[model samples]
Target chain A: MDTKIKTNNTTSEKIHSSENIDEQMLERLFRQFSQEIPDDGFTDRVMKSIAAVSQEESVSQKTAFSLKAQIPLLKSLNWFTAILSVAIFLFAGGPQLVWNSVFAPIFSNVTSILPVSVFRWTFDDWLVAFFRQAHQLYSIDVLTTPLPTIYILLAVLTALAARRLALLTV
Target chain B: MPSVTDIALVLQVVTIGSQRAFATLVERHQEPVRRFLRSLTNGDEALADDLAQETFIRAWQGLRSFRGSASFRTWVMRIAYHTFLDEVRKSKPTETLDSNQRIEPNATQTDNFMLRHDVQQALDSLSEIERTCITLQLIEGQSIADIATISGLPQNTVKSHLMRGKQHLTTYLRNHGYKD
Candidate 1:
């Protein structure tokens, strides 16, 4: 290749000391540089890589498809679990066991922490006390003062709407 | 074969994952692809071939996305250009042609080694975009629209690059004792 280039260069130099710079000359020079690159197993290597890539893609696709296909099965299993739990709760004295093992302990812990008089009050008494506290804090019967209640309700709704809008914007 | 169109080959590959069809496409376009990359890499044939291989592989994987609005060769060359750009971004090599590797193809003889050398050196004198535009326009015979598509440059920008790049090459050649 070197010898050939040297011979060509010698011949071209002998023919013309310097070729005229023209559009044709520029194209010719570019063509000389942009010769066809011989494919010395380039296609083979590319094909091999493509084959490996395809295999990897297919494997991942198959795994993804399988997972997608299992969605219904997983959903069905969820329903089955719900039904089984319901059945066990109904047929196996589940409520009593739960009350004894869970509610009783939790209630005991709560009662142990609070005053005994707090739990002694009826549901009506608790409700009355809550209303009395609200009336005391606001200096009016909130139920009787519908204007304040409505304004407060609107303010709460507006605040909630503003919070929701802020969240969406963020 | 000459009878089989690129679209037909591409369809076969897309529909059935035909390696044979893709292989034909690769072989058919590898020369221009490699040549384009070689110019971009300043005649580093090994790097050019590696980039070419990657371009073909990407073309194979992305065959489905090819809408055939452009010719398959153009699409592959676009891939090759992007692949070259990605390498450039990763490497962050010298900005000027003067700082880059010298142009030397491991192939057939040229009529003037100094002219070829001067041509590459002149190309190196331009900015990367200008060099790309010049190489695509002059060497690869790509049109302004096609060059824009390949390089993701605006048509006007490509035009300016070609203009500036050509002016630089003309000046360099003139300075190096080439007349007219």
Candidate 2:
């Protein structure tokens, strides 16, 4: 290694009597002085950073394929929207129907006997308005007439939420 | 085996995000890159090692751009050279505040307590390009053409830097009792 490092740069030289500027000698000294320090797990540390960075990249890639994210577009949501509407109505309307048929009469009788001046409890106006709006929404055919933009927004939001959930679990 | 065989293979594995294969590449190439950075930083082992880590990280990110136009070692050397330049430029202001900041690698105050006053005096005085060219040419035993490629200087420019750097180094050695 030392012998091969000798240079042939002889364009000029500064020699005084027995002394001379030597490129070959300079090359040798450079090699000798440049000591190689021992590597103490330098590679391991680098690999760890690489692992962390690559893991982040893979997570981003996985998020690209999230299930809920694939639910946009009315064409794709036709079946899902129908099923979702039915499930929503079942969960929301079930108690309402029971309340209207059974609880409303009982409540009315109880209130009639207990309230004249003190017990003045009627259904909250806001609650009634919310349920009324919910019923109107339930009556609309989701698959008919160019689907409301709110449904698309809801689907996108749900997809994004699903993606966030997937990332958290990871 | 050709050096590229190991580098190219491990590079493939790393592209698919395999840390193990990337570790192999790191292990194999760490010595030269670290050693190179060590000289560039004038034996500031900590800074050199940090820059070396940065070099490998950059290499890993830019692996796909390595089109095999040069050997992996040369490509890595190129990255390290640029990294060193960036570091030097970054550290230049602080270098003035402390005179001992830019000590020669072989300072008489450090390991080589007996090294005379003329130690790398000429090498120290050379321009950064000259210092880089000379270091790579001499210590690493790289060819002028390879140095040119690594430094992104023209071949002729590399030769000129090498010639001028050697002349000064020759004078520095002679004054320090280095006999031909």
Candidate 3:
């Protein structure tokens, strides 16, 4: 192993010494005859290209920044719409109005079309019974109902937060 | 005006996007960069200048990535080398004979031009990697490590190329009337 190491060292030294000789010869050749390229207008051309590149970069950056800047305004608009919808819904008696005008009528109509002879009640009477039951099921107190105002508002807020998070991830 | 260092110029260009500072850097290094390209292109002055211009432009665009490990000159030479390789890859195979035939010597230096012509001919005797290693080491005065970095070759490979390139160059120049 020692002998192999010594052999490698000697070989490397030989290569290095010969490499030095070649370097000297090359130096002589270049020192005597190497040309210096004159800069007639190269710098001007490069600077012009650089200016164009810089202009392109800045323009793109500005466009990206403007797009980013509009996000807050969009977010504010979304919040305003959400809040206004909730406010209009609550001011119109919330769940009670939804039950009376929307869900209760649908339930009453569905029952009115079904057979009502099983209980000796007329179709209209059955519909009236279903209407009262649905109204009670949905409840009259907006804040205390099954689908409470607070629960709906919380759901809306959670949805908005989730949407914002999705957009950010994108 | 006091001459600033390349590092200072580089700092100004990076921090402030100073075109004037970058222009100064281009002017300072253009000679060596152009000469290196001219050698690699085998004396095609027009192509050499075009490649050199591209090298500086790329350097400017990527100035922020310069880590100050190598001198600005070595870094730019690396860029010039890669730009030359990219051009070569994009084009047909190199016609050194045609390129040599295209060389128009400067009128003022007939004897030196003749010597340079002979040198270019001798350089033609080497393969591409050998010639690049030789040019980077001898003409551009880069170290073996620097050549490795510039060529993206290992140090041992660069050393081998240098050894072989030196032997070929010496034999060619010697046969062509360059006495020891």
Better of 1 and 2 by DockQ: 2
Regarding lDDT, does 1 or 3 come out ahead?
3
C-alpha DockQ of every model = 0.22, 0.30, 0.32
Candidate 1 matches the true fold with a TM-score of 0.64
What's the TM-score of every candidate structure?
Answer: 0.64, 0.60, 0.68
State the lDDT at B78 in candidate 3: 93
**DockQ category of candidate 2:** acceptable
Q: What is the TM-score of chain A alone in each candidate?
A: 0.32, 0.30, 0.40
Tens digits of lDDT, candidate 3, A41-157: 889999998899889999999998887776664555465566566556654556456566676666666667874443444443443565456558986343344444554554476
- Model 2 scores a TM of 0.60
Residue-level lDDT of model 2, residues A1-170, one tens digit each, is 54444332232232231143476677556656766656588988998887777788779878875744654533344445545654464346554576667766777777788774322333333334444466588874333333233334444555555455545554
Q: Is candidate 1 or candidate 3 better by TM-score?
A: 3
Chain B TM-score, structure 2? 0.82
The lDDT values for all models are: 0.75, 0.67, 0.78
TM-score of 3: 0.68
For model 1, report the TM-score of its A chain. 0.32
lDDT of 1 at B147: 91
What is chain B's TM-score across the candidates, in the order shown? 0.90, 0.82, 0.91
